[model samples]
Target: MTESDGERRPAGELEASVLAALWSAGNPMSAAQVRAAIPQPLARTTVATLLIRLHEKGVVGRSPAARGFLYFPVADSHGLTARRMHQELDQDHDRSTVLARFVEGLGPDDEAELRRLLEGGGQ
Candidate 1:
């Protein structure tokens, strides 16, 4: 959905957009730069707030800039996905069940790839 719809978006969606802008940039960007890069017409302050929140979450890192700060993702997309997976796993007490169900849900190709990785074949 577009921000023009005047609907409140989930914080995660906003954060993901901010991250996409940063990743595309491949360099630290100021809030204004991020705002311009994103498809959504968010205010500079809103972009800055999202960057600050991402920094707090360890998803992004920042450096002092002449105006405010330049934000960049701490990891690439795949690394972030892995980190999220780990976070989800860490939250559940029944890790074995969670992992089992996760493996069960995988398609054949993904299952083979996972098995290969598990057997240290990918290394």
Candidate 2:
């Protein structure tokens, strides 16, 4: 079904798809270029709008090009994941509880990395 047929996607899903397009390109792309790259049959205007939103969110960077602008991912997958995680953790007033829960959910390797980072070994 099409988007007009009541198929609404979550905000993050669209944002992630846009990011994936940019990431896969591995080079800066204009809004039009991005629109062409995505598999979804989205409107060119819709892709442009999403790129603008991602730019405003600081997840994408843009630079002036010939008649338009070129957009690129500001961070790779891991960096973006860390950014979102930090953003969520920062929103809670109870830092200890939030952090404790986050740590509790980490796997062994992730927990070890966290410990190393906390001890100033990892960066």
The model with the greatest lDDT is 1
Could you tell me how far off, in angstroms, the CA of residue 103 lies in candidate 1 after the best superposition?
1.4
List the candidates' TM-scores in order.
0.87, 0.83
lDDT of 1 by residue, 19-86 (tens): 99999999999999999999888887888889988999999999999999999999999999999999
Candidate 2 structure quality by residue, lDDT tens digits, 33-76: 88888877788888889999999989999999996789999999
- Provide the lowest-lDDT 10-residue window in model 1: 1-10
User: Which residue segments of model 2 deviate by more than 4 Å?
Assistant: 1-4, 121-123
User: What C-alpha lDDT do the candidate models reach, one value each?
Assistant: 0.92, 0.90
Model 2 steric clash pairs:
none
Candidates in order: C-alpha RMSD to true structure: 2.8, 2.5
Where does candidate 1 stray beyond 4 Å?
1-5
